[model samples]
Target chain A: MEPKMPRKERQIIATTITLLAVVFIYGYIIYKKYILENPELVYNLEFWGRKFFLMIPIMIGSLIILMIIFAIVNKILTNQDMETMTDEMDKLIELKALKISRWSTNICFLLAIGSQAIGKEPWVMMAVLVISCFAGAIVEAIAKIYYYKKGV
Target chain B: MGNCKIKNNIRTLRFMANEMTQQELAERTGVTRQTIVAIENGKYSPTLELAFRIAHIFNTPLQDVFSVDPDDLVLKKK
Candidate 1:
């Protein structure tokens, strides 16, 4: 039998997966409907800048909305407020996950720069940077889940 | 470094203390219930400060609540 996980862990896993889907699906739709259609914009710094700028608020809004809905549902089901207090163990686990995310992000930065140095298009570098950030976020979530499940 | 393992008797102590629930122990110790569960299951070891706090809550000596497993203990040669 699978061991039951804490409510907080389950919340993290669900939110991370849902956010990842929102990001990637939104990105793909934009790439297909807008960028692909306007092939010229692929090399346009201004166009990429506008797209990147728009994405930040959209992602942040999605996260805030998702958290609100998740918290409401969680509260109704569990009849407990969200665990907000940070204890020693929670701090340790968070630090470990942050370390993993930082390292992954650094490596991704190196790879993105390397692509640019190798004469890749500006879009390629931007794509690498964006994808690397998403990868780091997902990796941190996975690391937290692993540590929570298997012990720190 | 290879064989450092901590063994705890939190579950037993809680039982002896009038069948204290994990939630009760966690609230008294200022930690989440999942953390208490993890300690009981041997999935995570508490820090020294937390260990002392747990011992204090049980009104027991620190060594009584937590100890190095004898089988995993390593001694250095002088």
Candidate 2:
């Protein structure tokens, strides 16, 4: 038995894995290219601008592909039992996860202020903000999985 | 909620209803079998509407399917 995990829970777990993989892979590449190989790129806003601009498409594309893959497999396995709609427990779990993500974002903002006040470099602050967003996303996904496992 | 223990007789009721499996009951109640498992194991309490739905599925009274035995202080008031 596959344990009959709900489609919603499965989607949450899959999405979380995708986001984290992308973050780590993309983060490493960006760091090696800008911070290690070409240190001067960190000082240049154009480098950050172009890199993130490219990432927007890459991230969106990867997410869409992931969704399609999950849908295909889920439809095959669940057949008529495939449920894509939200239920009360799903909504509650989503809210619980969203609450944690929002709190993390607020903390990120506070840290952003502190970093600025302490005279950190503009690019360093930018990196912190980006990583914080990733952390928020990772936390949200983990919380959803946790609630799914423990019951909501 | 302050020592409020929500309990259900879903397992006993299912057995009486022709040895119904969790999947069968879940399909009838429009919930996942895991949710049925959670409810039976006392890990999660369903909402009032869902509770009523489950009772209806089993063709039993809501009071018969689920209950919350009041604490001593609350029971003393009865």
Candidate 3:
């Protein structure tokens, strides 16, 4: 394909990178708790569990805010492509991307469940779930770009 | 899976239309320039409705825009 690289694809890529950074930072922080100075933080299951519960809203809000910033950047990056509505081909690519992303997330969920069944730590479960969700978003963005450039 | 396909003269049509840019053609056809490029390069085949829309944007008949080989069909022509 000629591959013009649309604004939407750029936005998707920016968002994916941001999500990966966030996920990696979160993972590092969790890892620190387990290995760093007061190892008690890792054993504090209730605290991590509560923090994990609170993370849902925090992550959602952060992603929303980040996306808005990315959108503004995208507007500045492209001229008229953003003004146009998504055509049928674009929609089809989106559908395919979402399917692959969701499929990845579901597989990650199964892994989390299996870990929980094996009596793994709750913090590990939380980390895996949250990390994998972000990973799925990244996967979708990559897949979308691939299909757009290489054909569906 | 590659047994059948549609062919088009989008590049020729664009050339004839005063060297119309892909972006302009995409805007007229309500799709992204990337999609137009893909279609022109035979990397992607658009839906029937999209094909009609593209042909309409070029002010040409569907046959002039796209052609499917009868032999490629499950039911071949005599």
RMSD of each: 2.7, 3.7, 4.1
lDDT of 2 by residue, A8-74 (tens): 6778878878877887888789898668987887878778878878877888888999988887887
Residues B1-78, candidate 2, lDDT per residue (tens digit)?
Answer: 354678899999999999999989877877777678878988778888889999998899999999887662263332
User: Which parts of model 1 are misplaced by more than 4 Å?
Assistant: A1-3, B70-78
Per-residue lDDT for B1-78 in model 3, tens only?
Answer: 554777899999999999999989987877887788889988789988889998888899999999888878675455
Top candidate by TM-score? 1
Q: Give me the runs in candidate 3 sitting further than 4 Å from their true place.
A: A1-6, A27-46, A53-84, B1-3, B75-78
lDDT of 3 at B50: 84
Worst 10 residues of 2 chain A by lDDT: A78-87
DockQ pick, better of 1 and 3: 1
- Looking at model 2, the pairs that clash are none
lDDT of 1 by residue, A74-144 (tens): 78877777777778878888999989999999999999999999999998988889888888988889898
DockQ metric for all predictions? 0.73, 0.37, 0.63
